[model samples]
Target: MSIFPLDHRPDSSQISEFFQEVRCAAMEFVFPPACMMCRSEMPHRIFRTAGCTLCDDCLGQLDSGHGNACRRCGAPVGPFTIATDHCILCHRENYAFDGVIRMGLYRDSLRVACLMAKNPSGSLMSRTLADLLVDTQYELFSERAFHAVVPVPEHWAKRLIRPHYAAETMARQISARLKVRLATGILAKARWTPKQAKSPPVQRRQQQKDAFHVVGAGVQGQSILLVDDILTTGATADAAARVLKRAGASRVVVAVVAVSPPRA
Candidate 1:
């Protein structure tokens, strides 16, 4: 016997799906889409489904950090290292976050992508990058269904200048893909801090002191996945994770598009 019943008609959800499909087709016809990366015309299937503007060649260059890495901080480590604890780069300083998952090391093509993503004009690239992150790390995300995904807060001065927050945009895509709640305004920058990229490692912790705080509630005993564009000295992530832990979050995991190699 047919479980759905012989006389069952298409429900409201089915009708909505049909209309959405028609609308997409009409929009595609009206405005032919071009690749966001190289500006090449995208295939109909690729345009409609993947929502990626990068050509296959460019997409293939997005290296995934799959080999030996510091289990805690996600920094690339020597394969022969026997230490089970934090990597050398993370050993001295304390980090509140439980773990880190980075897409790749910051260099070459990935570096260029990160630079482009920082600007509002590169919104399309940001979306494509988010898609790439989720696709590459789907298994890790699936392992623990995170209670919430939060973007590392940008300072108010920077927020005023930028039209959109790239980290938040990426976090939204990740939250959608992982089927987790997107929590914004819960954590925020308490004060403007010097850019970590320009500061020396020894001075990073002091520069980021009291830089972040929690503004929203209901996070008690929940697991959080903090999102950022790049992980450098781990200063910013550590600062934010400290505040999150104080707010009662059980576990805070860091996720970023790229991780900078340790400075010499």
Candidate 2:
């Protein structure tokens, strides 16, 4: 027997969707939807795309830096720089992941939005960013066939307070969009480590060394897309990639919403 009573009705889904749309219209009429990024009231917001909540201005700046980046680290480079394989910022640093794909640099509105994404309340924003990233870089991602998408796992302690973690949310979104298997729960945090942003770059690598643990098999030949919200020093990602590699993943490519700009 079909579990849903609506399953027997051919137009039930359409009816439900119609009502949902009507409800949204009513709610919007009473309380206009605001842009998630800039908090501007979108009283007459005409959605240019299905799931976008950012204002046109914010959306415009979201991808302004995607064109120029170091292929190796996904860091923004100047117009004249040759970044096909490496840029000066990343050339000397050895990262464990094969390559990187980023939506943009961590700055201005993008930085504010990424910071918002870390909170549990920013789940929708997180997924929206994920969609934007995939939509923009679908071609770049297509260059390599990923067997699975894995989010750099959250430690269990933190998951309690903020269950809607950004990395996992983005990973789930990318997995669906890219049609790759999601390797959720396969890799996990063995212990809690200080946030990479807080630690000095010198100590970052050491802190992440034994932070992650792989819990499954069948990754012997898998190519994984490792999803995260930010890439700062390449230390935490390197450590995660190291464990993923040791777990027999053939290759791991790092994908993030933004990569930290090279410090002066």
Candidate 3:
């Protein structure tokens, strides 16, 4: 009897907190976390922000969209501004998503950052990229009140190969930053398709046709934000948006880390 000290036993919450602190300390020792962008050591203040791995200097270097951009697709238009709402691509091709908010053109440092974030070993960098996206596109996000944030679903085979899908991880970070619900498993890839980067515009659409479908019930009448790593042809976004709309989503907006320039 009385082997245990009943008066001094920690509650479950206290025990959980203690374990969490111990785990964090262990991780810090093992990983010795550094800035994702500049590879500098993360200071204490910067570490307080969840998934923040960018040093202040590197964070300031993020390239956000500038000049005249098409309102519908967020593509940069010519110097002599004409219509702000629609670009030639927007007029020629019909997209399912209502609008797009892109962080920057796919070039230079932004391109390098995107490639790095896609690497399987770059989970921390992926989180940092998400934080960057949130920081740069805060104004765009604040313009709309989305019901949920969903990442463009990766196929099961792809998921097994990489394990941590960059888009999904980025979506999680963005959802947290936006205080929106992160909805997963609602959209699924029906079949694997070849990469769209090299495919012609028409082929890109054909390859992605009926490739995605929606599951579950929460999407009905919800305004959804679909997150993706890149927006090249806009075909993939259109395909996914069609399914979401068919599943009763009132509106779908696309957010991506980078957007390719419109074809000549």
The predicted structure with the larger lDDT, 1 or 3, is 3
User: What's the count of clashing pairs in each model shown?
Assistant: 0, 0, 0
Candidate 1 lDDT (Cα, whole model)? 0.81
Per-residue lDDT tens digits of candidate 2, residues 76-160?
Answer: 7777876468877777887878889889888887898898998879889899899989988888899999999999998998888
Any residue pairs clashing in model 3, and if so which? none
Q: Distance from true position, residue 251, model 2, in Å?
A: 1.1
Q: What is the C-alpha local distance difference test score of candidate 2?
A: 0.85
Question: What's the lDDT of the predicted structure labeled candidate 3?
Answer: 0.83
Over 4 Å off, model 1: 1-32, 46-49, 64-66, 78-85
Q: List residue ranges in candidate 3 displaced over 4 A.
A: 1-52, 55-57, 64-68, 78-83
Q: State TM-scores per candidate.
A: 0.85, 0.90, 0.81
Across residues 58-156, which tens digit of lDDT does each residue of candidate 3 receive? 665665435556768979888798776677768876889999887778876678788888888767777777777788778989999999999999888
Q: Sorted by TM-score, highest first, which candidate order results? A: 2, 1, 3
The TM-score, computed over Cα atoms with residue i paired to residue i, of candidate 1 is 0.85
Candidate 2: where are CA atoms >4 Å away?
1-15, 43-47, 65-67, 80-83
